[model samples]
Target: MHDLIAAPFRNEHLVLRPGSQRAVKIGAAKFTDLENAVKAGRALPGWLVDVARRAWGVDTFDRPAHAAVLVRRPGPYEFSRATWELNLGCDFDCEHCYLAEKRFEGLDWAGKARLLHVMRDAGVVWLQITGGEPLIDPQFPAAYQLAHELGMQVELLSNGSQLGKPRMLELLAALPPTKMSLSVYGASPETYDGLTRRRGAFKRFTRGLDAAVAAGLNIDLSLIITNRNAHEADAMRAWADRLGVARREYANISPTIHGGAETLPSQSPEHLTQRAPFTGCPAGHTFFHADPFGRASICKVGREPNIDLPTEGVAGLARLGSIADSLMLRTGGCTGCQLSDTCRVCRPMAKVFQEAKAPLKNYCQHG
Candidate 1:
């Protein structure tokens, strides 16, 4: 069943169509073999065959594999449940902005619509609108509404500057988000503003948070742990506690990268050693990132164009499957490392190594 369900990735020419009822087809083949495989029953991967039979009511191999396919399809396509970076630009000039160098022009209405349509068609059931700050984009409300209309659970990540404004709060109230993530660099204005490099930002962010909470929006306080603010974790937890939010609401303590480059800081080794093992770095598997410039990356940190989906519509998501297949075949430091539990590897990392013609030691540590 594993082989059958994960079969398309093995053949470069195979393609799976996404929708309420999924279909699989091999390139240049007049008929799809999915039905044949389903008929083979016991000969097929047991888990896949069982899943197909139980889920889709397809008990025979000669029948369609729709019963075996999951919520969407049996391919590499997946969507973010709780995170996304909508654009690179932010309203605040945070000193630690990872994409500080990248411009932040918001996507136009048309582009936003296209993205929404593509996301809905690709089965992205949950999405988070992030950015330099998503609130800065005027089209944000429309994007949010569209995602909600398509039955996608939506979340917003913001520096919280705009939320304090009555109009912005009203807009947010009108849209009714599933959750809102506020990045609190510091508990106090002096410290927060110093980190953001934007005076008075801390006040605005807190005000926005207060307004959001009052409006009954589900809120998660995001913290960026770095050399300057790792000690603030307890303070942040206290703030969440005071606000009646759960402590587990805090997200991963993302290590600040030096200007989003592939190179790690001098303390990276120690940082990696101290960090807990993360089993879920589902880049090519469950999530992907597409920049404003139309380049599709497997993860937020992996910013490389493994595939270009422009004008390809839903069919373009197949590239993720292809990329995952490619990565599984990769040999070198990553091939058999037990440290894969702690190591992070993605197309962006691979691209950096491919371009530099050197191994990526800093990004992927072998056990």
Candidate 2:
């Protein structure tokens, strides 16, 4: 059931195409799959599958599988997932934040709701709510509830600070997100405070994580590697293991949103080994980001060919495709680069932050 709800999140161009007698297609750029007999498909039957309005009732049946009359539309496709920044204000002041020093100006409740409706109309069914700290937004509940009512999968991106509060936990329990992605700073209080410059962030994060876990919410915990806390990598993993939640590690950093080289901890050679990229990053194609004020961009740093969310027509989406395609050209540093095979960095990223020089960062060990 979650698979069908999560399909949109996995694919930007996910669409319902008619196939064979009664099969439907779940498509991404480089991947496509067929589904039939969805209700009897999985052992875990979720509310999303039963209540799914957009893709449900197309040809669902009680048969085993492959027993429906399916059809496909002609060529054009639209986005399936959207990342909306409800607010830029955060309670934490991390040194490596890409959106550093941004203010908290956003549309009011009514206007924000309208933007969500637009996304739904345009075929976006997976809605990712993110922020410097999305929990800080006063209108977060309204936005979250609206996504649920629209039958979109709601994912919350947070730093896990305010989530520990009693009121916040109650609200989350009432209307849980499809999933929550919370960033973990360090393994202990001392290192966490050193990196985030907050007094008791580790405590808050742990408490918040416990609250969410206790409430039976799916959680994904992430750790961003920096010079200050790289030594705690193993410890961090063990801590997540104790909590029994999924953990991820991040060793990459990009320039600030306005192209400023914000103050970041100096890294040791160990953190940089083999971190360059061989392919372009996904900004316009797989998914796109939109800031609080409705300024839409392919990614956070590569905000080129930006369009306002409200006025983003077919032309706006087309511009995103053009910008993304331009980055794939085999020119200059991209051609015959020694780091091509092992590099995880992208072209537009290099151009924006590094003058397309110095290999994104000093993290590459390729000779």
State the TM-score for model 1: 0.66
lDDT of 1 at 352: 47
lDDT of 2 at 249: 79
Supply candidate 1's per-residue lDDT for 141.
72
Residues 3-65 of candidate 1: C-alpha lDDT, one tens digit per residue: 122222224322221111233434423123444544554244444455555554656654344
Query: Judged by lDDT against the true structure, how good is candidate 1?
Result: 0.57
Q: List all candidate RMSDs to the true structure.
A: 11.1, 7.7
Candidate 2 Cα deviation (angstroms), residue 168: 2.1
lDDT of 2 by residue, 110-207 (tens): 77877777666555666789987998888987787777655566788898887788888887777667678899878889999888888988888888
The best candidate in terms of lDDT: 2
- Given candidate 2, what's the lDDT at residue 2? 21
Error of 2 at 31 (Å): 21
